[model samples]
Target: MSPTHFISIPVASPGITENLRKFQDLCGEKIHPHKVQYPSKLHLTIGVLKLFSDEEVQQACNCLSEFSAKIPPILCEQPLHGTLKNLRVMRGDNQFVKVMYSEFILSDDSDRLQNLADKCLEFFVERGFMEYQYNTTAVKLHCTLINTRWNNAGPRTINASEILSDEFELQIFGNCVLDRIDLNEMRADKSFVAENDKRYLNVSCVSFK
Candidate 1:
């Protein structure tokens, strides 16, 4: 496959972007953390559609358009720091200087958002599109962290005492609407670097609120 397409919500924040770039640079040059390259804009994936013919893509778009209209936009928060099993590294400042993945913070009253995701999956399934399966937790969210490797490293644990005792704020928020879906075709067989183009349907967003 050359490219692939999916429904996703991109995370854009200066704090995250700056640290992510630095982490990638360090991994690539000094630390030599095996194959830790920078990432494209981080995103929360809602769905993934297999490559389809042009006509099928058009149909998918129409369906997604209707789907978008039926749902109101969702707003959510970002994670500060959490523990995974084995990945991520901490630096001198006791900050999450290097991490493979970031968790999302969910609002307690997120039933509305969860309902929308459920309805979207039902809509796709009704249309013979069985590729829509959401996470089961009430959290009902996803995030773009680091790659799965770095088995030697475990969930990053920083020495909070060593660095600024005060908590560092590193969170971003955005309104996610079910905008247009893409019809990407993957050339590279690799899941990470599958080359593809995206024709993003109009997306509206609001920054930290």
Candidate 2:
């Protein structure tokens, strides 16, 4: 399986970078615990393919080339929500990102989101990867800024969603960079124990989308 392999997408936007800067100012010293420490570049995930042989990898890459030719990149804008209004930024089973981003401010465009995810999944399946499905409702397209341990730690003074008078402005929607895809290995020590050691491929970002 080529040791470990995956397909990944890159995500970085000016709006997002600005928001990260704001978060650093607002969050102060508490932001260092983040995996990236600070907000790194970001990207939307398209498909997840497993590792394969040289011929198989070439075949998969060919499939991706065809896919990119067919589907262009997508530019989108999503409203931002902080921990105050999102879900209190707690740490526990699948509760941090999903409970907040899923239910906060996104539109109920499950059908459309799922359709996109399914397209990615189908491509992987054709590449001989296993079939997996995530509900559009559960699909998180958000670029997170803070993820605090929800144990006995003290609460944050300000939440990302509540940065302004009422709501936080986390403008992440931008050009869909479909220029390339990357292969990343999944770490065994992820937040979710079950997802450890899982590997997949994803689309990086392109020049225009």
Candidate 3:
């Protein structure tokens, strides 16, 4: 069976990408450039689907399209403002840091975003596309800045406290408008630079109110 694909919303703001690029450059100076994420590929994942075949992927896409059509468009009162505050790592029960990402917080401190994510998960679960088990303790709305799955294989630890000292604590990546939700196929060969290209097909875009 093929690997499972993901459902997510792409962050298309150029300002956000440029700011993240600067952070990546800093990480390059401290760690390795390739270890950091390409700014262009920043996204907020909605849910993961256990799609192993082409037919399943198509069915998932159709499901998302129908699910989106019924709901009103997602809206933010003030152009969703987010801040890249701290650097954190995701650890499993074995205490292995599998993924590294930036902590994102909205200025409004609203639950609307989390509600949207829950809705996405609910839609997939009800349709038998995904399991009902909760992956994380809570649905943390975030943007993945770096993932070591492709770059590094061994278990490692990073001193986030030392690295985040001084002015690097909080970085405002600028505001973004949540206009569309795209169902994208996860591909191993895809990089941040190729995200804007036609290689990735948007199976469905959730309409906004």
Best by lDDT: 3
- Judging by lDDT, tell me the better candidate of 2 and 3: 3
Candidate 1 off by > 4 Å: 1-3, 23-39, 73-100, 106-113, 132-140, 148-209
Global Cα lDDT for candidate 3: 0.61
lDDT of 3 at 183: 75
Instruction: Tell me the deviation in Å of residue 177 in model 1.
Output: 10
Measured by TM-score, the strongest candidate is: 3
For model 1 the local lDDT of residue 146 reads 48
lDDT of 2 by residue, 60-122 (tens): 666656665434432232212221123233234432231122112224333443344456556
Clashes of each: 13, 25, 2
Assess the local accuracy of residue 66 in candidate 2 as a C-alpha lDDT between 0 and 100: 60
Query: Candidate 3: how many backbone clashes?
Result: 2
**Stretches of model 3 off by over 4 angstroms after superposition:** 73-85, 92-98, 133-138, 152-157, 188-201
lDDT of 3 by residue, 88-148 (tens): 6565532334466665566677766666777777787788886654565235666776555
Query: Which pairs of residues clash in candidate 3, taking residues 3 or more apart in a chain or in different chains?
Result: 73-208, 73-209
RMSD (CA, angstroms), candidate 1: 9.4
Between prediction 1 and prediction 3, the one with superior lDDT is 3
**What is the Cα-based TM-score of model 2?**
0.49
